[model samples]
Target chain A: MPRYKITFAYDGTKFAGFQIQPHQRTIEQTLKTVVNRMAKDPDPAIPVIGSGRTDAGVHALNQVAHFDFPFDIPERSMVRALNSQLPLDIVVKKAEIVPKTFHARYNAHKKRYRYRVKQGEFVDPFRRNYTAHYKYPVDIAKMQQAAQDLVGTHDFTSFVASGSQAKSNVRTIYEAKVYHDEALDEIVFEFVGNGFLYNQVRIMVALLLEIGNGQRPLNDVKRVIAAKDRQQARMTAPASGLYLVDVSYDE
Target chain B: MPRYKITFAYDGTKFAGFQIQPHQRTIEQTLKTVVNRMAKDPDPAIPVIGSGRTDAGVHALNQVAHFDFPFDIPERSMVRALNSQLPLDIVVKKAEIVPKTFHARYNAHKKRYRYRVKQGEFVDPFRRNYTAHYKYPVDIAKMQQAAQDLVGTHDFTSFVASGSQAKSNVRTIYEAKVYHDEALDEIVFEFVGNGFLYNQVRIMVALLLEIGNGQRPLNDVKRVIAAKDRQQARMTAPASGLYLVDVSYDE
Candidate 1:
């Protein structure tokens, strides 16, 4: 058996998520189907493990994943082969032979995610489907300050969705920042963490949005973290604005 | 009746096109529905004539349109009211009172359109739905020169679609230029023209793409235009990458 590392991107609008579902379209299923066809196996029961699970309508710029195949395929040829079978909205950017021990999910050191929100009276027709549109005037300065409070290791239980089944709620967030891209008329929230609880990024964004809109004070972010109750946080932001930017692992 | 001009932007992914269709979702239909509701008339036959009819999956940043309303509505309030009823993908940016004779489609003096194509092995997930993905390396210099030949007034019959029913294809092109946006890994094609025939932009893009990929000679653009035959042009580019950038009327 040979293991291969693959980097890919997807629109995520038509996909349920990266995880495989029984009958729904997913990134994992799409990848597996394409890879199997390329490997000359009609129904290869290959399991693909992604770096992380993105919610519905969440996109990925550089998502990393790995799968094991029974036969050897040239790395360069694999990229072309997989892409030919994949839909236009999804593309395999790179494929490389990796050490058998490399695990896409377990070996990841850090993951970065970005959430985009348009704060204006008019939304760009081209970007409307991919970005969250909010007409309420947001205070970017307030949001930036609130984002700073969310950095560092802490129990993110309050930010996790109520139905999340993660065993531990504690995670170390290396960085959290919010800024406005004037050219794009979008507010971006970026986070890099060792691991994130389910819906953690979306909830944090929701909290910052509340502060940005003056619905809550900037200091409310710290109180929300300390409270450790899901009820204490603001509503979860829509999934359309969220993106899995990149995943990294130690060599 | 008081006539009002409205400037709007929309993500055209979900729209059939900018025109009203029978039992089909369209940007024009949606806007007319909102206007009819606000007019306090049951099934009011309000018509929203756009500056141009963008194809399905094409976006608009500064699209102009006008409709006659029997009641007076403040400019700012009209924007807010229409936005409240419209989907998140469509937004009314500006609204102003215009002369009773104002016409959205007929009074336009010039229009500008932009076509975007991604030129890298890796596609941006955030932009995949909005940009055309072209993995082949493009010869930028040749494409730019080819675009230059397309500038100026001439019969654009070659660039028109086969089923186009326009009486005249002679339109003046003020400017036609192609440039690469390195930061975004995109090649942008901009054209300022008095008017465009059906699928003219897409056809021009396809010809440029053929030149970029070395399938057609750089000088072939002039020959295609001279031929004035729709079959002389290359395939029509996808509509997802096209955008209606602006519309101008003589003062």
Candidate 2:
């Protein structure tokens, strides 16, 4: 059986999340059902592996996944056919054959997540859902200065929720930066990391926002990381404004 | 009774149009229902008058309208209250008391409509409804030349569908211009006219698109105006691409 790597995009408003559950609608289960139904050789079902799970109401501009098929299907045809069956909010962007050893989750080298923030007196009606609206002015210089503390390897247990039971919380953040687009009145934070713990990105964003608003000191990020306590990181940003932007791998 | 002028915006996907009907959903009907339910001094119902009727699936950025109220309501409070009752897709941007004789439809000096076209091989999923996808390279210079001829006063009977029973087809076009946003892969046509006939904006957009694609000659706009036959203007563009951008009036 040949493995296929698929890149997809979804609006995230209509889905529960990228994982399967008993009664809730999910992207992973929806994709698997569509792929199996459309396959030339129908099966009980095909297991679909995702690079990572995105929370409900969290959109994905580019999400990578992999699945095996009993029969051969052209890459372009697979994309076109799957998109026809999937809901309009979810679209299969690209599909291609991959090596048997290639794994969507295990073989991933790096991932990039983007958080959008709209800081102004009023939120643009059209982009209200896509951006986390902050009704006050954000200090860009303070945000940039605070972001520097998170741009290194550290145990990020403080950023993750208490429910997570990971053996280790060590992760390396390659780049942590914020870019403001004046035309759109939006501030986008880009984070590229070797790996992220559960709710890591949202929690980091919450701290950054606090620092930007002058509520928290600029060095709070470093203190939170060093404390290694979940109670220290109090806020977790909403899922609606986070997007899994890109995934990279070693060839 | 004091008349209130309202400037509003709507996404228009779920709405049938701006008018009330037997069973279908509409922006005007929705507004009236909300206002009736929220009024401290409720009556039979308030009639909401729109500056012009937008076709089904057409959006609006700044559509102006008016209605009568028995009691005084602050402009800011009215906007906030109406918005709370309206759906997320529709928003009342402004609400203010106007002259008793200010009729939304008849007192207008000019109306501005915008048509968006995206010329690209692939339609972006995010903006599929907002822009009409034209899968070809458009000649900007040709579109400009054709637009020049479309400006100024002319009898536009050729552009109106047979269903319209207007007294005269003559209308003055104050300005007609096409702006290309290369970064967004969109071509926006802006028209400020004294009035437009039924289906006039869509038909003009279709003709402009044909001219931009080099299918029609630069003089086709002039020839079609002289023909005065609906058959001369063969195409009418989709309503999803049109927007009621502005409605101007004398102070």
Candidate 3:
């Protein structure tokens, strides 16, 4: 058997989510179906392990996954074959042979996420599916200054949604930043961290947006993290604006 | 009755073009349905006259149209009401009361169109609906030079599709230009002209793409226009990448 590491991207607009569900269209199930057909083994379906699961309507630029094949094939050929069979919404960008011990989920050391919010009174018809729309005015400078507090290790219980079953809430954020894209008239929020709690990025975005809109003080992030209460951050940005930009692992 | 001119935009991905059809959903039909409902008249449905009809899968940035209302309403109110009632894919941007003699189709003096082509070996899933995918290598300079020949009055019979009902094939192109958008990795072609016959822009784009790919010489545009035969230029670009950018009228 040969194990392969693959990098892929998906639109996520039409997918239920990245995880498998009964009678639901998901990225994992779609990949499994194609890989199983290629493996020519229905007895034990091929399994694809992703670095992490993205919520519904969340896009990915370079999602990493690992799967084992019953037979060996050229890496380039594998990429072409999978892309040809998969739907247009999903594209396998790269495939490479990897050691059997390598795991997509366990070996991942860092991940980066991006959230895009369009600033305008009316939703742009073309970008409705890709960007979250913000009607109120916002100060990008205030959001940028507030995001610095998200760095370093912190207990993220204040940001995690209630459905999460994680044993611990401590996480290290390597970098967090905010910038305004003038060309598209959009505010972009990026977070790079060792790990993130469920809905952590979205919650932070919501709080930052509030602060930028003057509903909260510029230093609200510090107070919210210290409180460690989910009620401190009530809003979570819409999933349509979120993207799993990249994932990292040691060679 | 108050006649008004409205500027709107739409994501044409799900529309069956700008013209009304018997059973298919179209931009014109959708607008009529909403406006008629607002007008509270079913016996005589309100009519919408667009500047021109766009082919299926073609987008528009500022498509202009005119309609008459049974009663008077403020311009701002009309815009807000139509936007609220129309689907998320269509948005009314501006509305203004115009003279009763104004015609959206005949009042236009100049029109601008844009065609976007993504340059890559593999199709980008995110841009599949918004851009045409071109796999072969292209030279922007060659395309730019070839496009210059199109910036003048000429008989465009070779570029017009077979179904055109225009009395003459003569049209004047005020400007034709091509530029590479590095950030998006797309080659954008723009045309400003007094009028274009059916499928003229698409056909010209196909010929320019061929010239850029080294299949045709830089002077192919001149030769093709001189031929005055439809078979001289056979290829027409896909509609997904075309956009009716703007329409101009004399005050």
On residues A23-50, what C-alpha lDDT tens digit does candidate 1 reach at each position? 9999998988877766676453678889
How far out, in Å, is residue A75 in model 2?
4.1
Best-to-worst ranking by DockQ: 3, 1, 2
Candidate 2 chain A — worst ten consecutive residues by lDDT sum? A120-129
Alpha-carbon runs more than 4 Å astray in model 1: A39-44, A139-142, B42-44, B122-125
Cα lDDT of model 3 overall? Answer: 0.93
What's model 2's interface RMSD, roughly to a tenth of an angstrom? Answer: 2.7
Cα RMSDs of all predictions? 2.4, 2.8, 1.6
Q: Provide the lDDT at B61 for model 2.
A: 93
- TM-score leader: 3
Error of 2 at B130 (Å): 2.3
Alpha-carbon runs more than 4 Å astray in model 3 = none
DockQ of each: 0.49, 0.30, 0.66
DockQ of candidate 3 is 0.66
Here, model 3's chain A TM-score works out at 0.98
Q: Write the residue-wise lDDT of candidate 1 on B1-251 in tens digits.
A: 77889999888888999988898899999999899988885554878788878888988988999998878888999898998898877888899999977788889989999999986675555676578878787888899899988899999989998777889999999999899876676899999999999999999998999999999998999999999888889699888899898999866
